[model samples]
Structures are given as structure tokens and as C-alpha cells.
Target: MQLTQFTDLGLRVVMYLAAAAPDSSPSTKRVAEQLQLSYAHTTKVVARLSELGVVTTRRGRGGGLTITELGRGASVGWLTRQLEGDGEVVACEGDKPCPLREGCSLRGALRRAQESFYAALDSVTVADLTRAPTRTVLLDLTRPAV
Candidate 1:
């Protein structure tokens, strides 16, 4: 299944925050400007992420947005399962099953493939997005109790 632009942008925003220093907090505007997303949309995504406990947002001076510990565990596969699940694919979400459901092997095949696709994504985490020194340093910085 193809990822919607919404999920894509959401992941990107998280990645940008993850890439920065732990104490480094960037505002939604900064993230939007850097990523070329509209402030409104980015704000919405950030809000949603905040609601989901994926990120933390703070107001006032020296306050901005930061990726939450849960954000690291938000794997690509988990994202796909959440956003691009069986229902996200319209053909599967319909009240009535597809006419070819019984006779078609394609549907089952596609279902299995989709599951596999998301399973692969699940293996990757925000940590996986970073390379070598950055990842190690960042991981240490974002350690659990902090």
C-alpha cells in the first residue's frame, strides 16, 4: 500500500526533530519552513502527534517541540498499520466485500503482501533513520529516563 502524503509528512517532521540535539527544540514554523510544508498542515500534524503522545510541545521562550520517547518506538510498520491499514485501502473498507473475494486469489495475495510490507516497516524505528555517529550519540542523548 502506498503511504499517504499526510503520513509521509508526519514521519518527516518527527525525523527532523529526532535529528536535532535532545535539548534542541524547534517550533512547528521552523520545521515547516525547513521541510517546505504549510504551517497550517504542519501544525495539525504536530497537534495530532502531540495528542498521540508521539511528541511534546511547549510554549514560551526556550520551549518548542520535541520528539517524545514513544516517538522512537513508533515504527514505520506500526505507522502503516495505523494509517495504511486494511481499511485505508478503500477496496477493503467497503461494507460489501469485493465481488471477487471468493474466487480471486489476488485479494488474498495482496492482503498477505500488505501485511509483509508493513511488517518490514515495523522493523525500522526513528533510530534506524540516523547514521553511525549521529545515531549513537543521539540515542545516548535521548536515553529513556531523560
Candidate 2:
């Protein structure tokens, strides 16, 4: 199953914060610019993350975004599940049911595959995505432009 852009951005934001220095709190604008994402979209994503208690935001001068402990420890699977919600993977359950609904195993197979996907993700945390090489790259990319 494909992840939505929202979820993708959220994961990127978390990884970026994870790679940053402990005391360095970056602003959403900086993150947007660094990641080449739209400022408005980043703002909305950050707001949702803040509301979810994954990231905390501070206002005014010297203020920025920081990942919470929960965020740091968040499993990729859990995050995806939360972000994706219970949305169906296929159109099998829509108003117009598939003709094969009664005897088809495709839905069940897809569901199992999705669960496997998440299960694999569960083994990795957000921090796990920021290993030395990746962390170094993210740090360089996230450095504010002069």
C-alpha cells in the first residue's frame, strides 16, 4: 500500500528532527525550505503533528519545532497506522460491491499483505531511519540557507 504525501512528510519531519543536534530546534519554514516542501503544507503538517503530541512547537523568537520523546521512539508502523487510519486499501467495500465479493480472496490477501508491511515497519523506529550516513546527509540538507 502506498502512503499519502501527508504521512510521507510527517515521517520526513520526524527524521529531520531526529538527525538534528539535540539543542537545535528548527522552524517549520526552515524545514519546508530544506525539504523543498511548500511552507503552507509544512505548517499544516506540523500543526497536526503537534496536536498528535508527536512534535512540540514554540512561538516567537528563539522558538522552533522539537520532536517529543514519543516521536523519537515512534515505530514507523505505528506512525503509518495512525496517519493512514482505517482507510480501505481497495474498493471492495465501497457502495458498489465487487461482483466477486462473495467468493474472492483478493481482499483478504491484500489485507494480510498490508499487515505484513506494517509489521515490517514496526521493527524500525523513526530514529532508526537516521543512521550515521543518513543523519549526516540530513544535517547537511537541513542546514539553514544564509
Q: State residue 121's C-alpha deviation in candidate 1, in Å.
A: 1.4
Model 2's lDDT to the true fold?
0.88
Tens digits of lDDT, candidate 2, 47-98: 9889888899999999999999999999999988887778767888668989
Estimate TM-scores for all models.
0.76, 0.90
24-102, model 1: which lDDT tens digit per residue?
A: 7888887887778999989988887887788899999988999988886678677555544345233643688677666
CA lDDT of each prediction against the hidden true structure: 0.74, 0.88
Off by over 4 Å in 2: none
